[model samples]
Target: MNGDWLLLGRDGRLSVYLPSDGAALWRAERAPAGPWEAPRRIGGDQELLPGLSIGRGPDGYGHLVAWRPVGTDRSDLVHTTHFRPLLAPLDWQPAGHPNKQGARTGTPAVAVDAQGRAHVFVRNGGGGMSMVAQKEKGGWEPWRDLKGRGVQEEPAAVTGESGRVELYAAVTGGIRHWRQEQPGARPVPGEGVDAAVRPGTLRALATSEESTTVLFTDDDSGELCAWRPGEKPMPLVAAAGPGPVSAVRCVIDGHDCTLVAQRSTSGRVAFAAYPSQQEALGAVWTESGPELPADAVVSLALDADGRLVAATLSPSTGQLRLARRKDEPGLALGPWQAV
Candidate 1:
């Protein structure tokens, strides 16, 4: 399979694009390099609501999940997997039943563990958080409610070095965390991590086997902060700024780092980096890249060559633009060129 960068987004419809060929992978039968292949329309004729989640499975396939409304108040969680071969079609399947009588909520969050099993988290019809996993043999398990009322957003999940899965979500009072120590283990909620973070702004990055980093915006100050397993939320920036609209954890120059795309109060979008997991709280965040419009929602991913790629959506124009930076060392993003 090719190690090219894969980007997914939705603007009236869902689409997938390969921005560039990082390695010399065979091209699709008739497709060539440059200007992403005509985006493959994956949403079909259905009304694809916002909130698309993508994860790479252990089998080297990419898994995607999104919510599609069925009735006035109900929506179903649609799933699909894609392979990397040039021109390989995306095979989307109805993973399971609708979200508990068609609950209207944010997009579901999916995480593929080292074992290659996918765990999906979302808000159910009753306004509680729920989850369902794909069985090892095949098929999906029934929906299991984790029981949290007034969930403000979809849950974020990541697998640890010990094979334990940790999940995080914003609740009525604060952010709630749960952990499944092992496969089939009931998810146990942790002590209150913090209550100062803004709802729906939580993003988790599992930087290494033994540690995971949580990033969110302060509810009162709007400043960016970081939290680890047993530490208090420490401010990464002194001044108030928009929390990360999109972030990703990837290795750069053999160092585990986080790339964050944040919007300032002045309505400018720029990229920042947190390079070391060990000194995350103390390390200075290096900012770079040209500012995007305030309305642009961005997503971050690392190409096979470890370069950073960003996809931005302009709501006013309804256009999805792709860009990348290759020369910067560490977290200093170079100038962006539209792909």
Candidate 2:
């Protein structure tokens, strides 16, 4: 599962972080439809774990957080950032403590708040939630646990419409959540909903200041479900395989909509667009492009030009394949091409 592998930087460029022997970056200038630049590997010989969690603020600063292997089984949560004048040197720093505590951290889910501070959440070694954030002045706060049991890996964290940071994770029987009452406030436990959430598939899309819609697959049935605060769980289409889905909120033909991409039954990328937060109105799934490898994971994001971009990372070649929404009516995408 991707913890937000692709992101749109402030300079109107879209960058995808690849977990190779080290952290690598591929930048496309004038994105949505881009002129892709050569891939540049960042960092020294530090070998990062597979997932890269990316977060950016309105001011355009971007941060990447991931687990870098320490000893045999432990890892250090390293965070790196990029701002203006793109040619600056990159620094990877271990947040909180190192592996000295014998903690084996998982991939982190990160989000930048209104103040441009990166908030990172990861499943701790004790099967609970542990988090670290960038202090307002500078530097990171201590790693603290947001108590919960049986928390899954790769929680979905996002800045809400009001700038408050919120998070959702797939827990034992359903999904659990945490949110800040206001911007820059510490996140406390929020109301959690009971649904059959597939671990690593719990994704939250913040539609308003007070609530976020969470989407996930049923662990037992493989069907999709959407859970909104104070609303009953709504059932969606079935996913042909067992991977996470990518969702982005954008305007289509002047109507607010949410675009979702998942693995089709035929092991290809499929897309669907529906009224945002109006799941009961129904959505129709359409498969796009030729078949991808059965294990390929797909994700979606809005490019700098406000175009909906759907992407899948090739498992065999490690190349990122991308397609953007067509300018015509309905849910259509241009030809899939490698970046």
lDDT of predicted model 1: 0.59
RMSD of every candidate to native, in Å, equals: 6.5, 2.2
* Tens-place lDDT digits, model 1, residues 1-339: 111124332111122332111111111212221354433455345455666666655455566676666777666777766555343445455665435564656657777676777778877666777888888787788888888777777567766666666777777766777778666565677755656767556777677767777677778875677777677777765432554446677667777767677555554556666674644454334444455566655667665455666666544544455566657565545455454
User: For model 1, what is the alpha-carbon lDDT of residue 277?
Assistant: 63
Per-candidate TM vs. native? 0.79, 0.92
TM-score, cand. 2: 0.92
lDDT of 2 by residue, 63-137 (tens): 888777777766677888877324432777888532235555566788888888989988877778878889999
Candidate 2 lDDT for residue 264: 78
